[model samples]
Target: MPALLRIGRTLRRTLLQAIPTVLGIVILNFFLLQLAPGDAADVMAGEAGSATAESMAALRSRFGLDNPVLVQLGHYLNNLAHFSLGFSPRYGMPVADLIAQRLPGTLTLMAFALTIAILLGVILGSLMASFAGRIPDRLLSIFSLLFYSIPSFWIGLMLIVFFSVKLGWLPSGGAGTIGSRLTGLPAILDKARYMVLPATSLALFYVAIYARLTRASMLEVKNQDFVRTAYAKGLTPFGVTARHILRNALIPITTMAGMHIGGMLGGAVVVETVYSWPGLGRLAFEAVMGRDFTVLLGILLLSSLLVIIANAAVDIIHAWLDPRIGAR
Candidate 1:
């Protein structure tokens, strides 16, 4: 009960700290949008083709563009308090609704990509650690470097060319079979099929980071006194390595995973665009291009919230894995 109470206190404190962080992000994003050149109203006007002064004024008033920046910020914050993200002038829908529509695709893609990264990274990192100073370790290091250095967009295009264009084994762009009505397992499989290339591209860079971090961490943990003690206590080599070395090394890997959430989201912008996948990243691209400030801010705030939550979760996991963390 005391431990649970401690965790509760930690969560409460973390949430209180997060409130100010979120407000600052909101304020900064609002001002940044204000500072950005080009008028959203003008963008709408141009798209409509030829606008008189009256029409322009009406457009500004309709979108609340006529309001002073401070008043607009106040209104935005007021709407946020009521669980509103404002309406998107570009999509002609509530920003929250537009985000809701795109959230599933982004979540799916990120889920697949992060899973691949974690699995492959842990495996490769273990291999490197087990084969330290051997050819296998060197080769894995080189492979990690290569993937880390390559741009995700380029990797995405290459995957599309090979898997979708040449082999025709998977989709080149977009989500699922275009215009085909699929349900149940068929729908899931179709979505996965379309997701392969983009997910792989997004995963590659993270894989590199995780592999390197894990390998270094494992090597360090392997030399620790606890690991030596485990081996001395009649534990099998595998047991000592797995229970002592790997488990201890995982603290750093867990930290990286938490940090990677943000990077993966940013990388999604490129991967989604390259593959024409209908995710938040692609929506963000369209929003920026159309000067859809509301949508853009909505995405930013949502992303920030996810990152904060992920970090808090990571801290809890860390405390669970090593009770010493709770003291810290």
Candidate 2:
């Protein structure tokens, strides 16, 4: 009961602290975009071709772009308080609806990418840790360094060239085949086929990071007194390493994994652009090009919320994994 109470208090405090962080992100995302020249009204007016001054003025007025920045901010906040994400002037649809439409694709991509990263990272990291000072460790270290150093966009393009263009094993771009009527299992397979290149591209950098982190963490824990004691107590070497050393090493891995959620989403912008996957990142790119402030801000706000939630969940997991964290 006391532990539960402590964890509850920690959660409450985390949430309280997050309020100011989220508010600051909202302000920054809104104002920074506003500071940039041009807006949805300008884009709309220009796209219309030879529009009159009065028509441009009316467009600005219609989208409330004529309002002062602070006034617009207030309106946005007020709408947010009412659970509203403002409409996108470019799309003629609510920003929330647009996000909802695109979110599933992004979620699916993230899920596959993250799962692959974790599995491969842990396995490779364990191998490196177990064979420290050996040929395999040296080889993996070089591999991880290369993976970490390369840009995701470059990796994505290279993957497309090799897997899609040369070998022709996968689709080069897009979430699915264009103008296809495939359905059910066939549709699922088609999407998965298209996903392979992008997911691998997105997952590679994180895999490298996690592999290095896991290797470092496991090595750090491997020599700890508890692990030595466990070994001394007649525990098998494998048992001491796997059941004890790996478990403790995972704390830092968990932390890195949770914190990387935002970064992964940001990276998706590049990966999705390269792959032409229609996810939130692609939507964000479109919004920026179109100066769709509502959709852009909506995406930023949603990303911030996801990051905060992920961090909060990490804190809770930390507490569960090591009760001392809850007490702190």
Candidate 3:
């Protein structure tokens, strides 16, 4: 029943769930990539008569394409064990390095957007729940519904026009200017300046979702016996609500937020493409167009890893916050 021991078991269970997910991603991507319409080797080699015949054979042998499907998959898995996702034969670079370089942009944007969304969602949701069925709550219900209905790509374009073009307050697309590196503060400012509009656009949809979730959670927790008891014990309305109601409602929000982290990355694909941010989303989109198999596989594997980790985090947070589940 000890908290530490309970946490250990919870973590073990979470990790165990990851094994099949990882294997599934590897297998699915492998088969699907094979099913696609062209020979990866030929695609990388370019036109049949364009490159020297001898050199094409060498490239194929170098990447292990000389082997059969099963042999190739085994080689792929072996390389993956050493953390070599694959080398992009087409791009002539390591896939892992490529993904690592672009990961920061996606992480920075997503982290900022999630922070803004959670802070705004919890606050607005709390207010909505507090004034449930009243005029303010009704207005919020309408607002969230309307905001949620807008497409992400459309919103990104609107933000670009209104803020970047019309007002000229933010950059139209690029993450930073050419010489941002020459000045540290300017680079940081430029980085954030470009991120603001895109991050805001991404945050809006999430806030709409989280607000509704928080509002429902707060309403449920508000009716619990602990809240009633605190109210009966001469506690002020705010005090009773803050200590008992907020703490209980937090468990649901924590779980929801953790689960949604992967969804944010998926959404980033559309958002990053819209703004032309140099991130995994844009990279994967480009890879598919170019028929860059190694890059596509790397992206799929990284995405699977991220989603699995997010799910594990949700379970761990759930156990930590509510010891009742940890006990079992």
Clashes of 1: 0
Candidate 3 lDDT score relative to the true structure: 0.85
- Candidate 1's error at 153, in angstroms? 0.9
Under the 3 Å rule for N, CA and C atoms, how many clashes does model 3 have? 0
**For residues 33-76, what per-residue lDDT tens digits would candidate 1 score against the true structure?**
98888777888888889888899899889989999999999999
Evaluate residue 121 in candidate 1 and report its C-alpha lDDT on the 0 to 100 scale: 97
Question: On residues 24-142, what C-alpha lDDT tens digit does candidate 2 reach at each position?
Answer: 99989998998888988888888988888898899889989899999999999999989999988899998899999999999899989999999999999999999998999999999
Per-residue lDDT over 1-328 for candidate 3, one digit per residue giving the tens place of the 0 to 100 score? 5777888898898888788889888988988997877655676667454777788788779877778988988988898889798888777899988999999999899999999999999888988999999999999999898779998889999999999889999887868876645467777888898899889888999899889999999999888888889998999988987888877888889888887888888899899988888888888887887677878988889888887887777787778778888877
CA RMSD per model (angstroms): 1.4, 1.8, 2.4
lDDT comparison, 1 vs 3, better candidate: 1
Each model's C-alpha lDDT?
0.90, 0.91, 0.85
Q: List the residue pairs that clash in candidate 1.
A: none
Clashes in predicted model 2: 0
Q: Estimate each model's TM-score.
A: 0.96, 0.94, 0.91
> Candidate 1: which stretches are off by over 4 Å?
1-6
